[model samples]
Target: MKQVKIAGQVVPAIGIGTWHMGDRPAQRETEIAAIQAGISAGARVIDTAEMYGSGRAETLVGAALQPFSRQQLFLISKVLPENASRQRMEASLDASLQRLQTDYLDLYLYHWRGDVPLAETVAELQRLQTTGKIRAWGVSNFDVADLRELWQLPGGDQAAANEDLYHLGSRGLDYAVLPWQAEHDLPLIAYSPIAQGDAWGQQLTTNDTVKQIALTHQATVYQVLLAWVIRQPQVLAIPQTSSVAHMEQNLAAGDLILSPKELAALDQQYPRPTHKERLDII
Candidate 1:
């Protein structure tokens, strides 16, 4: 499997994302099974957040991951912007830990910027590190300018990763964010990596180039998309799914590499941004 070094640990480039999961009691078993299937398929990173399902997702993850050794998995959760303050951060983290049924998180992130000063959040995250509740902390929905601002803070240079919306159709990060992260050796944890490009109103799934590339690799179009997302170094794709078969297929994409020719073709279909484009979000 292809691997990306994240927060000083090498993990599979493809991970399981738990967003909008654990919302329906009817689908609980299926969701747990899908996540377990990904783990059994060699996925080591499991991304969740306190905001997801208002903690239902983390609760589901806690149950799904009960059978696995904690050391074998790199678990990531996030604090809501309102809870990112020094006063409320640790308490929120504790609640997340309780939901996750774990004592510590591999990575905890500031879900987004809020009224709290960035320094307060960063300082609290650093303090949490000393408390052993979180190994490292990062940010989400952060653009290049936000990242640059973060890097200038006292403890900001220690950020382990950044989670953002990235997919074949959304290439805004390609112009600046990717380059900045690559230069700083900070890994990007991409969310919604296989949204089929429909979010941007593009029918990327039916694109001729995408179709032919999927055919060439004997993979699903979504799999081809996942492969393309993690084709670069220090990049990880966390694509959420509630089907065991789809989870397995997504994990398998870690090993699917597009050739230079194939990549050029995809580029022709969805060209990289020439200048800064609007940062796409879900």
Candidate 2:
């Protein structure tokens, strides 16, 4: 299986993403089952956020994790940008931990940049690490400039990872953000890694090259997309799904490797940005 290092621990590159999960009471048990199935399939990272359905996702994750050992999982949750301050950050993390039924998070992320000063948020996150409430802290939806500005802060360089929207169809990070991150030894947590469509409404699954590659590997287009996302070192892909079969398939993608020829073909079809492009966020 492909692996990525984060917070000094190695874990599977493919992880479970809980975005709109746990919002429907009707799908609660199956949602929990899907999570557990993913874990059983050897996915160690569970990415959730306090802001996801106002903590509903974290609650579901907590229940699903009851059957597993805590040390076997790497739990990540995000704090709202509004609460990323000295006064409320700790409280927000506490609530997140409560919902997750854990004493500490493997990683805590600032969901996005907000009105709070970056330095203040970084300092609070650094302080929270000492408090044992969080092991490491990072940012999401950050571009190259944002990362450079963050590294200028006192504790910003200590950020273990950054989560962003990345897929074969969205290669803007290829222009600058990826190089900067690779140089800094920072891992990227790619959300929406198997995106269905580009901004122009072009579907990747319909592309001739993508379809041919899927046939070549006898893998689904989604798996091909995921394989492309984690092709680079220090990158992880978290594709959200509510079905047990799909979760299993997503996890299985970690073992799929694309040839240089296949990769180049996909790149040609979805071509990397020639110039700096605005960071894409969901």
* Best TM-score among the predictions, by candidate number: 1
- What Cα-based lDDT does every candidate model obtain? 0.94, 0.93
Task: Write the residue-wise lDDT of candidate 2 on 1-282 in tens digits.
Answer: 999999999999999999999999999999999999999999999999988999999999999999999988999999998999999999999998888999999999999999999999999999999999898999999999999999999989999999999998789999999999999999999998878334446688788899999898999888888999999999999999999999999999999999999988887888989999989887
**Can you write out model 1's per-residue Cα lDDT over 1-282, one digit (the tens) per residue?**
999998778999999999989999999999999999999999999999999999999999999999999999999999999999989999999999999999999999999899999999999999999999999999999999999999999999999999998989888999999999999999999999987346667887888899999998899999999999999998999999999999999999998999999999999889998898878877
Please list the residue runs of candidate 1 whose C-alpha ends up more than 4 Å from where it truly belongs after superposition. Answer: 196-199
Of candidate 1, the 10-residue stretch with the lowest lDDT total is 195-204
Q: After superposition, how far is residue 236 of candidate 1 from its true place, in Å?
A: 0.3
Clashing pairs in 2: none
- TM-score of every candidate: 0.98, 0.98
